[model samples]
Target: MPAGSSTGSLLQTLFALILVLAVLGALAWFLKRYGPKVGGGNANVRVVGSLNLGGRERIVVVEVGNEWIVVGASPGRINALATMPRQDAQHGDHGGTNAALAPHSPAAHSFADWLKQTIDKRK
Candidate 1:
């Protein structure tokens, strides 16, 4: 057995294992901390009502009053939108002031969208 090759292979395998574990750990933590709530159970978000913004534009009523919002899952995509008439108003989000709010990575998509995009890009 070649000592150098065996040592290098062992190190590579260990690195790969560590990477996988780290990814899984992060995902689990995210799910536990920020996963949306459902029914009467605990969740990061709560659905209080439902409204059809338009045909096939059904939005689950989430936040309202201060800043009416319609959050829902569409085509496996989780979306949170402000349901106010004046979109550029001051009290939009109603969560808090975010003068620095901007689109992050063009708004993350669902796993299905990611998969579709990856395949489309390859073609």
Candidate 2:
């Protein structure tokens, strides 16, 4: 093999590698700037709270429109447990706590405690 040919081949390989890396970097930047949102872009539906019941079971509170729906989710099944009016967000009652479902006091037990008590009564 000619020395000149080997150097040309090495340069070609490096150029290909650099091109691939540049393409990958551009794709990552585009995705970071324009990818789908974490939860979703829908304004009508939002997850207000969630409590893990077991390894695969959880109770989720979802706010839809003017009401909040309690849902029980486990593996392949999801069931709506209850529905109630949406809580007021103006009083800092957003993101994972509902005053109607649990007491509203700094000294009070956490929402998980209230949920556990409610579940114990059903058994």
Candidate 3:
């Protein structure tokens, strides 16, 4: 093949690949933003909060109707860890001040603190 024809073929291939990637990226973003609400936002089931446990595992707190459920999620499986009534505010305080009152630490309580306190209370 002539040098010019080879260069033209290479350019065409690169343009086609770039177009496919752009289309795929747009589709992915669209799906991630709008996919979960397929059942409609009126379903009354929503994720209140989530904590990553590394890799694909995490703990997700979901509000289903008037109930709050703590779920352990990994890959294809999900397990309920705890269930409680949907409180006006998480951590029992209606004022939304569930943070540790330590002067040295930040006012906002980390998920670890909340998890530890919840576990200690159980014991």
* Candidate 3 structure quality by residue, lDDT tens digits, 1-123: 699999999999999999999999999999989777655557788877788898999998787997778799999999997766664555565422353323443443654665666677689
Q: How far is candidate 3 from the true structure (C-alpha RMSD, Å)?
A: 9.8
What local lDDT does model 2 show for residue 11?
100
Overlapping backbone residue pairs in candidate 1 total 1
Better of 1 and 3 by TM-score: 3
- Backbone clash pairs in model 2 (N, Cα, C under 3 Å; residues 3+ apart or in different chains), count: 0
RMSD of each: 17.6, 6.4, 9.8
Which 10 residues in a row give candidate 1 its minimum summed lDDT? 94-103
- Candidate number of the best TM-score: 2
lDDT of each: 0.52, 0.75, 0.72
- For candidate 2, what is the TM-score? 0.55
State TM-scores per candidate: 0.31, 0.55, 0.47
Per-residue lDDT over 8-123 for candidate 2, one digit per residue giving the tens place of the 0 to 100 score: 99999999999999999999999989996676778999888898989999999898998878799999999997666676653576745535443332321445654565566578
Steric overlap count per candidate: 1, 0, 0
Q: Which ten residues in a row have the lowest lDDT in candidate 2?
A: 101-110
